[model samples]
Target: MIRDWEKILLVYEQAVEELKIKFKSIRKEYRNTDEYSPIEFVTGRVKKISSIIEKAKKRNISIDSIEDGIEDIAGIRIMCQLVDDIHRVVSLIRDRDGKDLKIVEERDYINNMKESGYRSYHIIIKYPVHTAFGAKEILAEIQIRTLAMNFWATIEHSLNYKFKHNIPKDIKERLKTAADAAFLLDMEMSAIRDEIMDAQQIFQAKSTIVAKILRNIQYLYFSGKIEEIEDIRDRFFDLNEEGDINRLKEFNNYLEKLMDKYNIRKLI
Candidate 1:
Protein backbone atom coordinates (compact mmCIF):
# COMPACT_ATOMS: atom_id res chain seq x y z
CA MET A 1 0.00 0.00 0.00
CA ILE A 2 1.23 3.48 -0.90
CA ARG A 3 1.70 5.73 2.14
CA ASP A 4 -0.85 8.55 2.45
CA TRP A 5 1.74 11.32 2.06
CA GLU A 6 3.31 9.61 -0.92
CA LYS A 7 -0.05 9.26 -2.61
CA ILE A 8 -0.88 12.88 -1.99
CA LEU A 9 2.48 14.10 -3.30
CA LEU A 10 2.29 11.94 -6.41
CA VAL A 11 -1.24 13.08 -7.23
CA TYR A 12 -0.42 16.70 -6.55
CA GLU A 13 2.56 16.62 -8.92
CA GLN A 14 0.54 14.82 -11.58
CA ALA A 15 -2.33 17.26 -11.28
CA VAL A 16 -0.04 20.30 -11.51
CA GLU A 17 1.63 19.09 -14.70
CA GLU A 18 -1.69 18.12 -16.26
CA LEU A 19 -3.17 21.50 -15.41
CA LYS A 20 -0.24 23.28 -17.04
CA ILE A 21 -0.73 21.32 -20.25
CA LYS A 22 -4.47 21.93 -20.21
CA PHE A 23 -4.09 25.67 -19.64
CA LYS A 24 -1.59 25.94 -22.48
CA SER A 25 -3.91 24.13 -24.86
CA ILE A 26 -6.88 26.34 -23.92
CA ARG A 27 -4.82 29.51 -24.22
CA LYS A 28 -3.68 28.58 -27.73
CA GLU A 29 -7.20 27.67 -28.78
CA TYR A 30 -8.63 30.97 -27.54
CA ARG A 31 -5.72 33.17 -28.70
CA ASN A 32 -5.69 34.76 -25.27
CA THR A 33 -3.37 37.75 -24.91
CA ASP A 34 -3.73 38.24 -21.17
CA GLU A 35 -1.71 36.40 -18.53
CA TYR A 36 -3.36 33.73 -16.42
CA SER A 37 -2.75 32.82 -12.76
CA PRO A 38 -1.86 29.13 -12.68
CA ILE A 39 -0.77 29.30 -9.04
CA GLU A 40 -4.35 29.70 -7.85
CA PHE A 41 -5.41 26.59 -9.74
CA VAL A 42 -2.46 24.55 -8.47
CA THR A 43 -2.96 25.57 -4.82
CA GLY A 44 -6.62 24.63 -4.92
CA ARG A 45 -5.88 21.32 -6.60
CA VAL A 46 -3.26 20.43 -4.03
CA LYS A 47 -5.75 20.88 -1.20
CA LYS A 48 -8.31 18.72 -2.98
CA ILE A 49 -5.85 16.01 -4.01
CA SER A 50 -4.61 15.77 -0.43
CA SER A 51 -8.15 15.40 0.87
CA ILE A 52 -8.97 12.62 -1.57
CA ILE A 53 -5.82 10.71 -0.74
CA GLU A 54 -6.61 10.99 2.97
CA LYS A 55 -10.05 9.46 2.41
CA ALA A 56 -8.59 6.65 0.35
CA LYS A 57 -6.17 5.87 3.16
CA LYS A 58 -8.97 5.70 5.72
CA ARG A 59 -11.13 3.33 3.66
CA ASN A 60 -8.27 0.82 3.22
CA ILE A 61 -8.87 1.14 -0.49
CA SER A 62 -6.08 -0.43 -2.50
CA ILE A 63 -6.77 0.83 -5.97
CA ASP A 64 -5.25 -1.49 -8.53
CA SER A 65 -7.67 0.09 -10.99
CA ILE A 66 -6.74 3.64 -11.97
CA GLU A 67 -10.39 4.61 -12.30
CA ASP A 68 -11.21 5.53 -8.73
CA GLY A 69 -14.21 7.75 -8.18
CA ILE A 70 -12.81 11.06 -6.90
CA GLU A 71 -14.60 14.34 -7.31
CA ASP A 72 -13.32 17.20 -5.20
CA ILE A 73 -11.67 20.10 -6.98
CA ALA A 74 -12.87 19.58 -10.51
CA GLY A 75 -13.72 23.30 -10.49
CA ILE A 76 -11.62 26.20 -11.77
CA ARG A 77 -12.03 29.88 -11.04
CA ILE A 78 -10.94 32.38 -13.70
CA MET A 79 -10.43 35.96 -12.57
CA CYS A 80 -10.63 38.77 -15.09
CA GLN A 81 -9.88 42.49 -15.05
CA LEU A 82 -13.43 43.72 -15.68
CA VAL A 83 -17.03 42.46 -15.69
CA ASP A 84 -17.15 42.55 -19.48
CA ASP A 85 -13.79 40.83 -19.70
CA ILE A 86 -15.09 38.12 -17.38
CA HIS A 87 -17.93 37.37 -19.76
CA ARG A 88 -15.60 37.35 -22.77
CA VAL A 89 -13.18 34.91 -21.14
CA VAL A 90 -16.05 32.69 -20.01
CA SER A 91 -17.29 32.46 -23.59
CA LEU A 92 -13.84 31.45 -24.74
CA ILE A 93 -13.55 28.81 -21.99
CA ARG A 94 -16.96 27.39 -22.86
CA ASP A 95 -15.97 27.03 -26.48
CA ARG A 96 -12.68 25.22 -25.91
CA ASP A 97 -12.39 22.17 -28.19
CA GLY A 98 -10.61 19.12 -26.91
CA LYS A 99 -11.36 15.50 -26.20
CA ASP A 100 -10.53 15.94 -22.50
CA LEU A 101 -12.38 19.22 -22.05
CA LYS A 102 -15.87 18.94 -20.53
CA ILE A 103 -17.73 21.56 -18.54
CA VAL A 104 -19.53 19.78 -15.73
CA GLU A 105 -20.73 22.91 -13.94
CA GLU A 106 -20.51 26.69 -14.11
CA ARG A 107 -21.23 29.54 -11.70
CA ASP A 108 -21.16 33.31 -12.04
CA TYR A 109 -20.79 34.51 -8.48
CA ILE A 110 -20.73 38.11 -9.58
CA ASN A 111 -24.28 38.11 -10.89
CA ASN A 112 -25.78 35.38 -8.73
CA MET A 113 -24.68 36.68 -5.36
CA LYS A 114 -27.33 37.32 -2.71
CA GLU A 115 -25.80 40.63 -1.67
CA SER A 116 -23.46 43.25 -3.16
CA GLY A 117 -20.84 40.59 -3.70
CA TYR A 118 -17.94 41.27 -6.04
CA ARG A 119 -17.60 39.66 -9.47
CA SER A 120 -15.93 36.35 -10.45
CA TYR A 121 -16.48 33.40 -12.79
CA HIS A 122 -16.09 29.70 -12.11
CA ILE A 123 -16.07 26.48 -14.14
CA ILE A 124 -16.03 22.83 -13.15
CA ILE A 125 -14.28 20.71 -15.78
CA LYS A 126 -13.65 17.02 -16.01
CA TYR A 127 -10.49 16.21 -17.99
CA PRO A 128 -8.81 12.86 -18.39
CA VAL A 129 -5.28 13.21 -17.02
CA HIS A 130 -2.71 10.50 -17.70
CA THR A 131 -0.41 9.77 -14.78
CA ALA A 132 2.92 7.94 -14.72
CA PHE A 133 1.25 4.68 -13.62
CA GLY A 134 -1.80 4.83 -15.89
CA ALA A 135 -4.45 6.96 -17.56
CA LYS A 136 -6.97 8.44 -15.08
CA GLU A 137 -9.83 10.87 -15.45
CA ILE A 138 -9.62 13.70 -12.91
CA LEU A 139 -11.84 16.68 -12.31
CA ALA A 140 -10.33 20.16 -12.21
CA GLU A 141 -11.71 23.46 -10.97
CA ILE A 142 -11.08 26.85 -12.56
CA GLN A 143 -11.94 30.22 -11.07
CA ILE A 144 -11.56 33.67 -12.63
CA ARG A 145 -11.74 37.02 -10.88
CA THR A 146 -10.77 40.64 -11.25
CA LEU A 147 -7.70 41.79 -9.29
CA ALA A 148 -9.73 43.69 -6.70
CA MET A 149 -12.31 40.91 -6.41
CA ASN A 150 -9.50 38.41 -6.00
CA PHE A 151 -7.98 40.46 -3.18
CA TRP A 152 -11.22 40.47 -1.23
CA ALA A 153 -11.84 36.77 -1.82
CA THR A 154 -8.32 35.81 -0.73
CA ILE A 155 -8.76 37.60 2.59
CA GLU A 156 -12.20 36.09 3.12
CA HIS A 157 -10.91 32.62 2.27
CA SER A 158 -8.09 32.92 4.76
CA LEU A 159 -10.57 33.90 7.47
CA ASN A 160 -12.88 31.00 6.67
CA TYR A 161 -10.01 28.53 6.54
CA LYS A 162 -8.55 29.75 9.80
CA PHE A 163 -11.86 29.47 11.64
CA LYS A 164 -12.89 26.31 9.86
CA HIS A 165 -16.13 28.04 8.77
CA ASN A 166 -17.07 28.79 12.40
CA ILE A 167 -16.00 32.40 12.47
CA PRO A 168 -17.21 34.77 15.17
CA LYS A 169 -20.43 36.62 14.40
CA ASP A 170 -18.83 40.05 14.62
CA ILE A 171 -16.02 39.04 12.27
CA LYS A 172 -18.45 37.51 9.83
CA GLU A 173 -20.49 40.71 9.81
CA ARG A 174 -17.34 42.77 9.28
CA LEU A 175 -16.29 40.49 6.42
CA LYS A 176 -19.62 41.01 4.70
CA THR A 177 -19.27 44.75 5.14
CA ALA A 178 -15.77 44.57 3.73
CA ALA A 179 -17.04 42.61 0.76
CA ASP A 180 -19.58 45.36 0.10
CA ALA A 181 -16.86 47.99 0.30
CA ALA A 182 -14.76 45.99 -2.18
CA PHE A 183 -17.65 45.96 -4.66
CA LEU A 184 -17.92 49.74 -4.48
CA LEU A 185 -14.19 50.00 -4.78
CA ASP A 186 -14.19 48.01 -8.04
CA MET A 187 -16.85 50.25 -9.59
CA GLU A 188 -15.02 53.38 -8.49
CA MET A 189 -11.75 52.11 -9.91
CA SER A 190 -13.38 51.22 -13.21
CA ALA A 191 -14.75 54.76 -13.54
CA ILE A 192 -11.39 56.24 -12.62
CA ARG A 193 -9.64 54.04 -15.18
CA ASP A 194 -11.94 55.22 -17.99
CA GLU A 195 -11.48 58.87 -17.02
CA ILE A 196 -7.71 58.48 -16.89
CA MET A 197 -7.60 56.78 -20.29
CA ASP A 198 -9.64 59.55 -21.85
CA ALA A 199 -7.38 62.17 -20.31
CA GLN A 200 -4.29 60.33 -21.59
CA GLN A 201 -5.62 60.38 -25.16
CA ILE A 202 -6.13 64.13 -24.93
CA PHE A 203 -2.62 64.56 -23.61
CA GLN A 204 -1.24 62.40 -26.42
CA ALA A 205 -2.95 64.55 -29.06
CA LYS A 206 -1.59 67.80 -27.63
CA SER A 207 1.88 66.31 -27.13
CA THR A 208 1.98 65.25 -30.77
CA ILE A 209 1.37 68.82 -31.88
CA VAL A 210 3.93 70.18 -29.43
CA ALA A 211 6.51 67.65 -30.64
CA LYS A 212 5.99 68.53 -34.31
CA ILE A 213 6.25 72.29 -33.62
CA LEU A 214 9.42 71.82 -31.56
CA ARG A 215 11.02 69.64 -34.24
CA ASN A 216 10.24 72.17 -36.98
CA ILE A 217 11.76 75.00 -34.94
CA GLN A 218 14.86 72.91 -34.23
CA TYR A 219 15.25 72.14 -37.93
CA LEU A 220 14.84 75.83 -38.95
CA TYR A 221 17.32 77.05 -36.32
CA PHE A 222 20.31 75.33 -38.02
CA SER A 223 19.60 77.01 -41.42
CA GLY A 224 19.28 80.75 -40.72
CA LYS A 225 18.45 83.48 -38.20
CA ILE A 226 14.72 83.94 -37.45
CA GLU A 227 13.91 86.69 -34.90
CA GLU A 228 10.50 85.16 -33.93
CA ILE A 229 11.67 81.59 -33.31
CA GLU A 230 11.81 82.45 -29.61
CA ASP A 231 8.18 83.51 -29.82
CA ILE A 232 7.33 80.14 -31.46
CA ARG A 233 9.13 78.34 -28.63
CA ASP A 234 7.16 80.36 -26.06
CA ARG A 235 3.92 79.51 -27.88
CA PHE A 236 4.85 75.81 -27.78
CA PHE A 237 5.16 75.96 -23.98
CA ASP A 238 1.82 77.79 -23.72
CA LEU A 239 -0.05 75.28 -25.91
CA ASN A 240 1.47 72.37 -24.00
CA GLU A 241 0.00 73.59 -20.72
CA GLU A 242 -3.37 74.64 -22.23
CA GLY A 243 -3.87 71.24 -23.99
CA ASP A 244 -6.68 72.74 -26.10
CA ILE A 245 -6.71 71.84 -29.82
CA ASN A 246 -8.73 74.91 -30.85
CA ARG A 247 -6.39 77.21 -28.97
CA LEU A 248 -3.43 75.47 -30.64
CA LYS A 249 -4.96 75.99 -34.12
CA GLU A 250 -5.50 79.68 -33.37
CA PHE A 251 -1.92 79.99 -32.17
CA ASN A 252 -0.70 78.22 -35.33
CA ASN A 253 -2.65 80.65 -37.50
CA TYR A 254 -1.13 83.60 -35.66
CA LEU A 255 2.37 82.16 -36.20
CA GLU A 256 1.60 81.65 -39.88
CA LYS A 257 0.52 85.32 -40.25
CA LEU A 258 3.74 86.42 -38.55
CA MET A 259 5.85 84.15 -40.78
CA ASP A 260 4.14 85.50 -43.91
CA LYS A 261 4.60 89.13 -42.90
CA TYR A 262 8.31 88.57 -42.13
CA ASN A 263 8.89 86.34 -45.22
CA ILE A 264 10.51 83.79 -42.86
CA ARG A 265 10.34 80.90 -45.39
CA LYS A 266 13.14 82.60 -47.45
CA LEU A 267 15.36 82.36 -44.35
CA ILE A 268 14.75 78.60 -44.18
Candidate 2:
Protein backbone atom coordinates (compact mmCIF):
# COMPACT_ATOMS: atom_id res chain seq x y z
CA MET A 1 0.00 0.00 0.00
CA ILE A 2 1.11 3.55 -0.72
CA ARG A 3 1.32 5.01 2.79
CA ASP A 4 3.20 8.14 1.86
CA TRP A 5 1.06 11.24 1.50
CA GLU A 6 2.99 12.29 -1.59
CA LYS A 7 2.32 8.96 -3.30
CA ILE A 8 -1.35 9.05 -2.34
CA LEU A 9 -1.65 12.57 -3.70
CA LEU A 10 -0.09 11.41 -6.95
CA VAL A 11 -2.71 8.68 -7.16
CA TYR A 12 -5.40 11.34 -6.90
CA GLU A 13 -3.66 13.28 -9.63
CA GLN A 14 -3.61 10.22 -11.84
CA ALA A 15 -7.32 9.72 -11.28
CA VAL A 16 -8.08 13.32 -12.28
CA GLU A 17 -5.93 13.08 -15.41
CA GLU A 18 -7.60 9.87 -16.51
CA LEU A 19 -11.10 11.33 -16.05
CA LYS A 20 -10.18 14.53 -17.90
CA ILE A 21 -8.82 12.54 -20.82
CA LYS A 22 -11.99 10.50 -20.99
CA PHE A 23 -14.25 13.55 -20.83
CA LYS A 24 -12.28 15.28 -23.56
CA SER A 25 -12.76 12.23 -25.72
CA ILE A 26 -16.52 12.50 -25.22
CA ARG A 27 -16.43 16.17 -26.23
CA LYS A 28 -14.52 15.32 -29.39
CA GLU A 29 -16.96 12.57 -30.24
CA TYR A 30 -19.83 15.08 -30.21
CA ARG A 31 -17.97 17.72 -32.23
CA ASN A 32 -17.32 15.15 -34.97
CA THR A 33 -21.04 14.79 -35.48
CA ASP A 34 -23.85 17.28 -36.14
CA GLU A 35 -25.43 16.71 -32.74
CA TYR A 36 -25.43 19.33 -30.00
CA SER A 37 -23.24 18.32 -27.05
CA PRO A 38 -24.39 19.00 -23.52
CA ILE A 39 -20.86 19.54 -22.34
CA GLU A 40 -19.76 23.12 -22.96
CA PHE A 41 -16.43 22.68 -21.17
CA VAL A 42 -14.79 20.36 -18.64
CA THR A 43 -12.22 21.12 -15.96
CA GLY A 44 -10.73 18.97 -13.20
CA ARG A 45 -8.26 19.05 -10.33
CA VAL A 46 -7.04 17.07 -7.33
CA LYS A 47 -7.56 18.54 -3.89
CA LYS A 48 -4.52 20.43 -2.63
CA ILE A 49 -2.39 18.92 0.14
CA SER A 50 -3.19 21.56 2.72
CA SER A 51 -6.89 21.54 1.81
CA ILE A 52 -7.04 17.77 2.16
CA ILE A 53 -5.44 17.96 5.58
CA GLU A 54 -7.86 20.69 6.68
CA LYS A 55 -10.87 18.77 5.45
CA ALA A 56 -9.76 15.59 7.21
CA LYS A 57 -9.33 17.50 10.46
CA LYS A 58 -12.66 19.26 10.11
CA ARG A 59 -14.48 15.98 9.54
CA ASN A 60 -12.64 14.30 12.41
CA ILE A 61 -11.55 11.67 9.93
CA SER A 62 -8.46 9.62 10.46
CA ILE A 63 -5.77 9.76 7.79
CA ASP A 64 -6.60 6.18 6.82
CA SER A 65 -10.29 7.06 6.29
CA ILE A 66 -9.57 10.19 4.28
CA GLU A 67 -10.68 8.56 1.03
CA ASP A 68 -14.08 7.71 2.48
CA GLY A 69 -14.59 10.92 4.44
CA ILE A 70 -13.38 13.35 1.77
CA GLU A 71 -15.05 12.33 -1.44
CA ASP A 72 -14.04 15.31 -3.59
CA ILE A 73 -10.31 14.76 -3.63
CA ALA A 74 -10.52 14.12 -7.35
CA GLY A 75 -12.94 16.70 -8.78
CA ILE A 76 -14.20 17.31 -12.31
CA ARG A 77 -16.50 20.18 -13.26
CA ILE A 78 -18.64 20.11 -16.39
CA MET A 79 -20.34 23.30 -17.52
CA CYS A 80 -23.36 23.32 -19.78
CA GLN A 81 -25.20 26.18 -21.47
CA LEU A 82 -28.66 25.06 -20.35
CA VAL A 83 -30.20 23.42 -17.28
CA ASP A 84 -31.46 20.54 -19.41
CA ASP A 85 -27.94 20.13 -20.74
CA ILE A 86 -26.79 19.58 -17.17
CA HIS A 87 -29.17 16.68 -16.75
CA ARG A 88 -28.26 15.34 -20.19
CA VAL A 89 -24.61 15.32 -19.20
CA VAL A 90 -25.47 13.45 -16.00
CA SER A 91 -27.35 10.79 -17.95
CA LEU A 92 -24.59 10.59 -20.52
CA ILE A 93 -22.04 10.02 -17.79
CA ARG A 94 -24.18 7.35 -16.19
CA ASP A 95 -24.90 5.55 -19.46
CA ARG A 96 -21.48 6.28 -20.90
CA ASP A 97 -20.04 3.29 -22.75
CA GLY A 98 -16.94 2.51 -20.76
CA LYS A 99 -15.69 -0.08 -18.33
CA ASP A 100 -13.24 2.15 -16.48
CA LEU A 101 -15.87 4.68 -15.32
CA LYS A 102 -18.83 4.01 -13.00
CA ILE A 103 -21.13 6.25 -11.03
CA VAL A 104 -21.08 5.42 -7.32
CA GLU A 105 -23.42 8.16 -6.11
CA GLU A 106 -25.30 11.29 -7.18
CA ARG A 107 -26.37 14.49 -5.45
CA ASP A 108 -29.10 16.56 -7.16
CA TYR A 109 -28.13 19.85 -5.67
CA ILE A 110 -29.56 21.83 -8.58
CA ASN A 111 -33.09 21.01 -7.52
CA ASN A 112 -32.12 21.35 -3.87
CA MET A 113 -30.06 24.51 -3.86
CA LYS A 114 -27.97 24.91 -0.76
CA GLU A 115 -28.72 27.62 1.78
CA SER A 116 -25.62 29.40 0.54
CA GLY A 117 -27.29 29.62 -2.91
CA TYR A 118 -25.05 26.95 -4.37
CA ARG A 119 -26.65 24.85 -7.11
CA SER A 120 -25.07 22.03 -9.09
CA TYR A 121 -25.63 18.34 -9.82
CA HIS A 122 -22.80 16.30 -8.41
CA ILE A 123 -22.03 12.69 -9.30
CA ILE A 124 -19.48 10.56 -7.53
CA ILE A 125 -17.76 8.14 -9.86
CA LYS A 126 -15.25 5.35 -9.40
CA TYR A 127 -12.43 5.63 -11.90
CA PRO A 128 -9.81 2.96 -12.36
CA VAL A 129 -6.29 4.31 -12.48
CA HIS A 130 -3.42 2.13 -13.63
CA THR A 131 -0.22 2.55 -11.68
CA ALA A 132 2.93 0.53 -11.07
CA PHE A 133 1.16 -1.17 -8.21
CA GLY A 134 -1.76 -2.21 -10.45
CA ALA A 135 -5.23 -0.93 -11.26
CA LYS A 136 -6.61 1.12 -8.39
CA GLU A 137 -10.20 2.26 -8.16
CA ILE A 138 -10.42 5.90 -7.10
CA LEU A 139 -13.49 7.94 -6.25
CA ALA A 140 -13.97 11.18 -8.21
CA GLU A 141 -16.60 13.90 -7.97
CA ILE A 142 -18.22 15.36 -11.09
CA GLN A 143 -20.19 18.60 -10.82
CA ILE A 144 -22.54 19.49 -13.66
CA ARG A 145 -24.10 22.91 -13.86
CA THR A 146 -25.29 25.57 -16.29
CA LEU A 147 -22.88 28.35 -17.25
CA ALA A 148 -25.00 30.88 -15.39
CA MET A 149 -25.03 28.69 -12.30
CA ASN A 150 -21.28 28.31 -12.57
CA PHE A 151 -20.91 32.07 -12.84
CA TRP A 152 -22.92 32.64 -9.66
CA ALA A 153 -21.25 29.77 -7.80
CA THR A 154 -17.86 31.21 -8.72
CA ILE A 155 -18.69 34.61 -7.26
CA GLU A 156 -20.33 33.14 -4.16
CA HIS A 157 -17.34 30.86 -3.59
CA SER A 158 -15.02 33.85 -3.75
CA LEU A 159 -17.16 35.69 -1.23
CA ASN A 160 -17.24 32.65 1.05
CA TYR A 161 -13.47 32.37 0.86
CA LYS A 162 -13.01 36.01 1.76
CA PHE A 163 -15.46 35.65 4.65
CA LYS A 164 -14.33 32.22 5.74
CA HIS A 165 -17.52 30.59 4.43
CA ASN A 166 -19.69 32.76 6.66
CA ILE A 167 -20.84 35.86 4.88
CA PRO A 168 -23.00 38.54 6.52
CA LYS A 169 -26.78 38.09 6.39
CA ASP A 170 -27.26 40.90 3.87
CA ILE A 171 -24.59 39.47 1.63
CA LYS A 172 -26.16 36.06 1.86
CA GLU A 173 -29.56 37.40 0.89
CA ARG A 174 -28.06 39.25 -2.07
CA LEU A 175 -26.32 36.07 -3.15
CA LYS A 176 -29.62 34.24 -3.09
CA THR A 177 -31.19 36.93 -5.25
CA ALA A 178 -28.30 36.69 -7.68
CA ALA A 179 -28.79 32.94 -7.80
CA ASP A 180 -32.43 33.43 -8.72
CA ALA A 181 -31.45 35.84 -11.46
CA ALA A 182 -29.02 33.29 -12.85
CA PHE A 183 -31.70 30.64 -12.76
CA LEU A 184 -34.08 32.89 -14.67
CA LEU A 185 -31.40 33.66 -17.22
CA ASP A 186 -30.89 29.96 -17.86
CA MET A 187 -34.63 29.47 -18.30
CA GLU A 188 -34.86 32.36 -20.74
CA MET A 189 -32.00 30.98 -22.81
CA SER A 190 -33.43 27.47 -22.76
CA ALA A 191 -36.72 28.82 -24.14
CA ILE A 192 -35.01 29.42 -27.49
CA ARG A 193 -32.65 26.51 -27.21
CA ASP A 194 -33.25 25.08 -30.66
CA GLU A 195 -32.71 28.39 -32.42
CA ILE A 196 -29.50 29.03 -30.51
CA MET A 197 -28.21 25.53 -31.18
CA ASP A 198 -28.96 25.82 -34.88
CA ALA A 199 -27.13 29.10 -35.16
CA GLN A 200 -24.17 27.73 -33.20
CA GLN A 201 -23.98 24.62 -35.36
CA ILE A 202 -24.09 26.68 -38.52
CA PHE A 203 -21.40 29.00 -37.24
CA GLN A 204 -19.16 26.12 -36.22
CA ALA A 205 -19.65 24.36 -39.52
CA LYS A 206 -18.80 27.57 -41.35
CA SER A 207 -15.65 27.95 -39.29
CA THR A 208 -14.59 24.42 -40.17
CA ILE A 209 -15.17 25.21 -43.82
CA VAL A 210 -13.07 28.35 -43.58
CA ALA A 211 -10.26 26.45 -41.91
CA LYS A 212 -10.34 23.73 -44.55
CA ILE A 213 -10.32 26.34 -47.28
CA LEU A 214 -7.29 28.11 -45.84
CA ARG A 215 -5.37 24.86 -45.43
CA ASN A 216 -6.13 23.74 -48.97
CA ILE A 217 -5.22 27.16 -50.38
CA GLN A 218 -1.93 27.12 -48.52
CA TYR A 219 -1.21 23.60 -49.75
CA LEU A 220 -1.98 24.46 -53.39
CA TYR A 221 0.18 27.60 -53.33
CA PHE A 222 3.16 25.25 -53.69
CA SER A 223 1.49 22.37 -55.51
CA GLY A 224 -0.77 24.08 -58.05
CA LYS A 225 -0.57 26.94 -60.51
CA ILE A 226 -0.26 30.40 -58.96
CA GLU A 227 -2.84 31.87 -61.37
CA GLU A 228 -5.56 29.42 -60.26
CA ILE A 229 -4.60 29.80 -56.61
CA GLU A 230 -4.77 33.58 -56.75
CA ASP A 231 -8.21 33.47 -58.40
CA ILE A 232 -9.56 31.09 -55.77
CA ARG A 233 -7.97 33.20 -53.05
CA ASP A 234 -9.65 36.33 -54.38
CA ARG A 235 -12.99 34.56 -54.49
CA PHE A 236 -12.48 33.37 -50.93
CA PHE A 237 -11.81 36.91 -49.74
CA ASP A 238 -14.80 38.33 -51.64
CA LEU A 239 -17.12 35.69 -50.24
CA ASN A 240 -15.75 36.24 -46.72
CA GLU A 241 -16.11 40.03 -46.82
CA GLU A 242 -19.71 39.76 -47.96
CA GLY A 243 -20.57 38.12 -44.61
CA ASP A 244 -22.93 35.79 -46.39
CA ILE A 245 -23.17 32.22 -45.12
CA ASN A 246 -25.11 31.07 -48.16
CA ARG A 247 -22.31 32.34 -50.37
CA LEU A 248 -19.85 30.52 -48.20
CA LYS A 249 -21.84 27.35 -48.52
CA GLU A 250 -21.93 27.79 -52.28
CA PHE A 251 -18.18 28.34 -52.25
CA ASN A 252 -17.76 25.03 -50.41
CA ASN A 253 -19.87 23.39 -53.07
CA TYR A 254 -17.65 24.93 -55.75
CA LEU A 255 -14.57 23.61 -54.00
CA GLU A 256 -16.01 20.11 -54.01
CA LYS A 257 -16.51 20.24 -57.77
CA LEU A 258 -13.01 21.61 -58.34
CA MET A 259 -11.23 19.11 -56.08
CA ASP A 260 -10.31 16.92 -59.06
CA LYS A 261 -8.67 19.82 -60.88
CA TYR A 262 -6.45 20.57 -57.86
CA ASN A 263 -6.02 16.91 -56.97
CA ILE A 264 -7.25 17.80 -53.47
CA ARG A 265 -9.29 15.50 -51.31
CA LYS A 266 -12.73 16.63 -50.07
CA LEU A 267 -12.57 19.40 -47.50
CA ILE A 268 -15.88 18.72 -45.75
The best candidate by TM-score is 2
lDDT of 1 by residue, 1-268 (tens): 4546556446545665666666556644432322332222222444454555565576665553222444443334444445555666667667873655777788778877644354567776776667678776566667776667888888877887799767788887887788778778767766775664456456655655556566566655554556667777887787768778768766666656655665766666
Cα lDDT of model 2 by residue, 1-268, tens digit:
3367777879889888878887788877876664677888889999888888898998898888888778899999999999989888888887863666878889998889887778999998887788998888778899999999999999998898899978999999999999999999999999999998898777767676787777767766656544677889999999888868778878877775666566655432
TM-scores of all candidate predictions against the true structure: 0.54, 0.91
Worst 10 residues of 2 by lDDT: 259-268
Candidate 2, pairs of clashing residues: none
Residue 163's lDDT within candidate 2 is 96
TM-score of 2: 0.91
Alpha carbon lDDT of each predicted model: 0.61, 0.83
Off by over 4 Å in 1: 1-5, 8-12, 21-44, 48-70, 74-77, 114-119, 189-268
Find the candidate with the highest lDDT and give its number. Answer: 2
